[model samples]
Target: MYRYDEFDQQFVSARVEQFSDQVRRRLSGELSEDQFKPLRLMNGVYLQLHAYMLRIAVPYGTLNTRQLRKLAHLARTYDRGYGHFTTRQNLQFNWPSLEQIPDMLRELAEVQMHCIQTSGNCIRNVTADHFAGAAADEIVDPRPYAEILRQWSSLHPEFSFLPRKFKIAVSGAAHDRAAVRIHDIGLQVVKNDEGQIGFTVFVGGGLGRTPFIAWTLRDYLPEADLLTYCEAILRVYNLYGRRDNKYKARIKILMHEAGLDTVRAQVEEEFERIRGGVLTLPEGDVARIRAYFAPPAFESLPAVSLVETQTAARDPGFAAWVATNTHAHKVPGYVSVTISLKPVGGIPGDASAEQMEAVADLADAHAFGEVRVSHQQNLILPHVKRDDLPAVYRGLVAAGLATANAGLVTDIICCPGLDYCSLANARSIPVSQRISERLGDPARQAEIGPLLIKMSGCINACGHHHVGHIGILGVDRKGEEFYQITLGGSADEVSAIGDITGRGFSSAEVVDAIDTIVNTYIAHRASPDETFLAAYRRLGMQPFKEALYGNA
Candidate 1:
């Protein structure tokens, strides 16, 4: 909900003008792809398999209905009629022509949005919990600090180009919905003995060819020193991180080569030097940013809504949707609703322009004009009053956005694989679709309970397959597509990278293999109460392995 200031407005307008001229030159042959690649990347434009893909930042996953409407407009006017919401909480347009990118950016700028810092070697968009302000269990809203980091990292002269791209996530909730542990830097909101707020900082976590859970950089960092400490960590990564090999350039690799203690010592030394410098955030600045994200003026209400109860009693479908898609809210009578983009057998996160527009209207009507994009490739009505959920459900049903499977087996997280990404070794979306169709039954999905299936086209882990309970990575085998499976990984407070299964399955066999694994879990699990992750962890990989490959 942060509004752009005059300075912010001027800055974005200037960036647009700069990029427009750059595009003009590229079109005129003054700049070749070799010369223009970095420039386009800086603005979040990628020359993918078939066309230019534009990724627009959704800072901390927060958006107003107006901003979402603008995104819908872009989807309709500039590119294909649908856009994909990605795991990084950004939106990607896969079919935009090179010529229209500047115009698309200008349109985004009109709505106080931009693609800046969404890509490239500089720090990318700072992500936070989608339900930052609305979650019942949050310690404090993380968006203010996320916005601060965004402001500091955006075109920072010191970090315009680094050894590798950096990503940071902040989680206000103890549940770690932001997947903080797998980011380059992760900040978890915590309180000390005296109930003073601070952050538990984690550094050097990432997923690619190699995946790591970040090390504890600071057990507790005072709120005032957030920026200073962050700079210290980035300084270490920037200075010592490898540049000779792109694969080894990430901070995770640096952490791997240099022990955690040594990295901590270096960061501490740097922190001491800059502790009281200009980067030290003042109470006033934090307060000013927080004002932009202050909780909406919620009306006092009872703990539960009789209207919702009555509506659910009348419609089992609505009841099922409510059970699967809504989460507890801090405010009584309100629940954060996850609008499942991973509809049964459809592309995971693709939303039509009409669907986006419909969601915008629903958010305005039911969620106080606020919406959120989740890292799981879902949309959120973060402050939906329980009283309005039935009407919201009706709107979604009409828009073909109603899917009663938010955390269920069918809610798969997938990337735009070989279908669009040039780096992809195999197609991912079709594999994901086939898996979804195989497990699309609402009753079956409900029986499975809280399964996370993530698929990546390649090892870049764009779809976050490394952290999934059931991870699928598509790979090229000789001349055909094969999928490698992994189990028991999670992206939560207790995060772990998945262990790969024995072998890869052909595209045709992958879905049936998934079915075999699910059936194995079902048969071996102690109870339905034991989730897929819990069962996988408890039984280890032996049972699942036996199911996937028949015992000799």
Candidate 2:
């Protein structure tokens, strides 16, 4: 994890002071709601349906146990006992009072965390794979690069007010866990023909009203020119991206209208102008950043833990948890454990203050005092020793953070819809809750295999319904909630937008429809080993549609 330097510390301290005064003015009526809107938004405060929601950036989804404990304290002191982890790998205090926000910001600043750049029409939090440094399949760790971009883009003069909000996500592994293709800017670590490390840059991918898979702007961007090339893309977008229509303001719409070649040519021209300039990252600077992210010390141990194997062999519950919730680590004796926030019928990413503190404690005891937030709304202990799996599981179970379902059907990604979001046309949480309850059994989910059921309250795609294996979109029809289903979507290396199934289901019929879809896939899949995504892609949407609407 990258720690703030003296300059970084001073910068945050100044911003917190500025925002604190701004908040005071707003509360005292010196600033009206209309006058305070931009100020509050700039500070990451959103006036949601019921109350204010403060989104705090979790840079590259990495936090030390101390930072996590501080957040737990803030959640306990202010708000209503819980914080919601968002699809951006950020945390949102959904019920924070406007008056309490300044103190909250001050508290966050104490731990090198802040709500800066979390909202408004500028660069948002730069996210990377949650398993960045630890994943066995990763080519390189992308967080250091992400941090570099953060340093360059934070409070940059030019991009302060783009056509709309911008999001950048980085993925270092071959598997694309960061949903790279669906961000305003996506960077994938790649090795060139010369065996030199670089990036494969994608531009204009986003998932709002008009979802788009980013175009390959540069197949191989040299590591040194990262900032320069990135500046070129931003310059082109800022120069021509729409400002008239809010709906068409995103870079994705620009990519759709301008075409990839046109944008690429413009970006290349800009890059040529800026290359070898101040923006080019020096080798020493790169090395320094890389050194900051060096892996923690590990004891020399065998690949398999004998105690772990024996315990799992005895306890079916432990075996199930181990089977689903743990991932292979780069280090032989360690594993990355996923603490699923999705309980049987709980809100997808809502973690209570107590739960956060417990996870912080677990990270201190087992992991390297580090906690990670996954884009899929789960918390990750990125470096847990395999030998300590049972004790970790027990601790998680005690804290109500143990849900055993990671990639299974019940491990759903859902947005807070009509319940909290003002933009929602329908309720997403209760619907997902019902679906979870319907398929909550561990055996049933295990049988179903890896399934991603994402639900969005609207077309904003906050739940990433665009790329879900079983995608559900809620729409308002004649003052009633109707859910639309999309099939065969995935957010992996072979990213694909889900195809819509005809018509919509009533809220009452939605869960049953999902069951129908799942059962249809199970019946038609070639083997138990075949995943829901594979089955859907193999059989196409015909069988699933027939099952949902009936052949008649």
Candidate 3:
């Protein structure tokens, strides 16, 4: 994690003081609600349907043990006893009092975390792969670049008030775990033939009322010109993106109207003008940012461990958990452990204050004190020793984080729909909870195999439903809760947005509809080995649609 320097410290402290004064003015009647609206939003505060919601940024989804502990403290002392980890790798507190937010911000600042740019029509948190540095397939860690973008875009004068919110994601692994295609800007770090690292930049990719898969703007953007090229894309969008209608203000609409070629051409023209200006990322500056993300030391050990194999044989529960929750690490004798937030009927990403604290302690004790928040709404101890698996699992089980449902059906990614978001038309969390309860059996989920089921409350696509293998989007019809299902969507190297199966289903019918789709795939798949995505790709959505709608 990057430690805050004096400038960074001063900037955050000043912002906190400013926001505190603004809140005081609002309370004292010196500033009306209308006047306080923008000020509150700029500080990541939202007046939700029920209460004030504050989103706190977790930069590039990386945090140290101390930071995790601070989040736990916030949850315990300030708002409710839990925090909702969002799809963008940030956390949201649903019930923060308006007056206490500044104190909360100060607490966050102590740990080098803040809510700046977490919301409100500006560049939001930049997400990267959870396994950025530790993934076996990574060419380079994407966090340094993400941090650079964070610094450059924070309180940027020209882009402080865009037409709508902007999101950017980065991924270094061949697998697109970051869902880069569904963001305003997606940067995939790739190595050229000569082994020099660069980015493959994608633009106009977003999910909302209008979902668009981003188009590759450049095949290879040099490391030095990342900010310059990014500035060009934003300049193009800022100048021409629709602003008359809030729904169409996103760059996706601009891409739809201007055509990708025309937009790319304009961006290219702008890039040439600013390639060597203030936006140019200098070599030493890059080095300075990279220094903050240095890799942890690992001890060499033999590949196959008899103790681990024996432990697996002794306890089927631990074995299953190890099989699902643990991932391959770049180093030998170390495994990446995913602490699942989705246990059985629990909320998808709600971690209690105690759970957060336990995760921090586990990270410190077993994994070099580094923690990562996954885009899938889980926490990762990226470098746990294989020998510490049982102890870690015990700790996680006690904390309700030891769900062996990673990549399984119950490991749902959901947005805080009507429950917390004012813009939501339907409730997303309850639907997710219902589906999860219906599919609560761990054995059943394991047998069902690998699946990515994502839910968004509305077309805003905060839950990233468009990219889930089975996507669920909540909608409202005549003031009733309804759900629209999309199938075969993937967010990987071969990413494709899922297609709507047919008519919407009522809230009660939605879970059964999902079950029908899964059962249909199970019955009609080519072999037992064929995954849901594979079978869907082979046969298309008609069979599943027919099964769900029943000969409509």
Ordering by TM-score: 1, 2, 3
lDDT by residue for model 2 (1-552), tens: 788899999999899899889888988999999999999888899999999999999999999989988888888899888899989999999898989998999899899999998999999999999999999999999999999999999999999999899999899988899999999999999999998889999998888688888899999999999999999999999999999999999999999999999999999999999899999999999999999899999888789999899999998988989999999999899999999999999999999989999999999999989999999999999998999999999999899877889999999999999999999999999999999999998889888999999999998999999899999999999999999999988887888899999999999999999999999999999999999998887889898888888886
Candidate 3 Cα errors over 4 Å, as ranges: none
Number of clashing residue pairs in every model? Answer: 0, 0, 0
**Candidate 1 per-residue lDDT over residues 1-552, each given as its tens digit:** 799999999999999999999999999999999999999999999989899999999999999989999999999998889999999999999999989888998999999999998889999989999999999999999999999999999899989889989999999989999999999999999999999999999998999899999999889999999999999998998899999999999999999999999999999999999899999989999999999998999989888999999999999999999999999999998999999999888999999999999999998888899989999999999998899989999999999988999988999999999999999999999989989999998889888999999999999999999999999998998989999999989999999999998899998899999999999999999998999999988999999888888794
- The C-alpha stretches of model 2 lying farther than 4 A from their native spots are none
RMSD (Cα, Å) of model 2: 0.8
| TM-score head-to-head 1 vs 3, winner | 1
Off by over 4 Å in 1: none
Give per-residue CA lDDT, model 3, range 218-330, as digits (tens).
99999999999999899899899888999999998898888889999999999998878887888999999999999887878766667778888998989999999998888
Clashes of 3: 0
Of 2 and 3, the candidate ahead on lDDT is 2
lDDT order, best first, reads: 1, 2, 3
True-structure RMSD, every candidate: 0.7, 0.8, 1.1
User: In angstroms, how far off is 427's CA in candidate 1?
Assistant: 0.7
